[model samples]
Target: MRITWWGHATTTIEANGTRLLTDPVLTSRIAHLRRRRGPAPLPEAGECDAVLISHMHADHLHLTSLPLVAPDAALVVPRGAAKLIHADSGPAFSDRCIEVAPGNQVRIGSLDITTVTANHDGRRLPWSGHSGPAVGYRVEGAPSVWFAGDTDLYDELAAEAGPVDLALVPVGGWGPSLGPGHLDAVRAAEAVRRVRAKIAVPVHFGTFWPIGMDWVKPELFLPPGDKFKAAVDPEVRVELLEPGESIEVLA
Candidate 1:
């Protein structure tokens, strides 16, 4: 299986003759957030068999980026996403969107995706009236990969994920300080141990940042990946990749 980090939570996973994209943030700017590192996601990031959106957060599920996905690509989003993803402002993805709650499974090409719980708020906007449970995806293919979209460490994480060959975990956020419902380097390492993954990749770090804050806590912008790698148990291999970097793994 092959995985490429497209910056932040956006990633491309190629396995079992299928190409899947996760939480794609294709724009160079999203409100106050800007693509401070790595190149903006290219058009090919949208060239996939399916797209998995983890939550309703603008960064994770940009309404504008929805159209980038090939019209035929399956879109797996949280149950309450239709209203937000298909807002009247633009084209509707209602036809391609597959709403799912935790434990629900959907098939797209060679991948069987199972939704799992994530510890984070799933609201799109303060008054958007769209809300749902946050989730992670356990993609079963040639090499099972668990894409834990923005989440904190929860006790049932390992059990919910089942056996994973590669764990794509979030070790940091876009800001200097991560509030509740987020993972830091230490917690991310703990997650690696809990999931019992043979290999792990630290994501959601060194990517986007609040505009004008680049000079602040500069290290926070990109060091978390390495920090998480350093904290992980030696038994598990941690492959830390920069934005647009790729790695190949076997089940």
Candidate 2:
């Protein structure tokens, strides 16, 4: 499988003749977070068979960016989150929605995707009703891949060793200090090692930053990926990719 990190949590995975984009934040800026590294994803990045939305946070599920992708691309979102997408992207996009929860499985083209549990809250807004489990995705193809949307390490992280060929784990966030349910560099490394992923790519860091607070702990932005790379087990290969960089993970 070929994976391209499109800054922040957005990524494009091409495998088994199908394309899948995760938490596509295509635009250069969203709200106060601006793209701090690499150029915005090109139009071709929108060419995907499916879009995997890990949760309802604007950073992960930017409603405006939904239309930016191919109209035919199915939006795979957390269960009960389809209404939010419908309200934001309209019925046209909602009609193609495939709502799923942890363990729920769906096939998109040749890819078999299984929704997995995440520790983060998935409410549409901070003030909105916060219920249900946040989610990540385990995509099965020639080489299975794990896309851990935005979560701190879970106790069952290593239940299955080496289950995935490649794991896309979040090492940090756009903010200076991370909150609960978000992994920093060290914790992210442990999570990857626990799963025994043959190859890992650090995401959710070094991409976007706050508009005016570049001076406030700027180390939290780009350094986390390097830290994660340094901390991962030597047995596991770490591919610390910059935004828009692609790597091929062989099965």
Candidate 3:
């Protein structure tokens, strides 16, 4: 299996001849955030059989970058989140969306993508009124992959996902404080242990930063990848890739 980290939470999972892209923020900037480390995702990043969106956060559920997916690629998003996008992206755009909550599963060619619960709130906006749980994905194929979209550690996490070969974990965010429902390097390391994954690749860190706050808690930006790697158990292999880099794993 080949996995490419496109900076932040965006990653391309290639296995069993099927490709999946997650939470693609393909542009340099989103809202008040700017890409600080990696280059913009190459065109090949958008070429996927399906697109996995973890939640409704602008960075994870980037509306503008949604069109970058292959024409026929499935857009898998949290339930209720699709409606928020269709209103702005046109009704026709909704045709490609496959909304899911935890425990739901969808087949994409040679892989079976199942949604697992994430402990984050996925509401589109403060007053938007849409509601649904955030989610992660478990891709069952040659090299089983667990894409832990955006979530803090939960008790049933490992039991629900029935993990396989590789795990893509979110170790940090763009801002200084991670707040309530997020994982820092220490917690992310614990999560890797919970999932019992053989290989772990840290994502959602060392990439984007707030527009003018580059000097504030700068360690929260790029050092997370390094920290997560150091925190993980030595028994489990950690493949920490820079944004835009790919690693091939034999599962």
Which candidate has the highest TM-score of all?
Answer: 3
Q: What is candidate 3's lDDT per residue for 122-167, written digit by digit as tens? A: 7776657766789999998777889998899888988986555788
Q: Pick the candidate with the highest lDDT.
A: 3
Q: Each model's C-alpha lDDT? A: 0.87, 0.87, 0.87
What lDDT is reached at residue 205 by model 1? 87
RMSD of each: 1.3, 1.4, 1.1
Off by over 4 Å in 1: 88-91
Error of 2 at 215 (Å): 1.0
> Candidate 2, which ten residues in sequence have the lowest lDDT sum?
154-163
Candidate 3: pairs in clash = none
Model 3 alpha-carbon drift over 4 Å, by segment: none
Candidate 2 regions off by >4 Å? Answer: 130-132, 160-162
Task: Determine which window of 10 residues in candidate 3 has minimal summed lDDT.
Answer: 123-132
Provide the TM-score for each candidate, comma-separated. Answer: 0.96, 0.96, 0.97
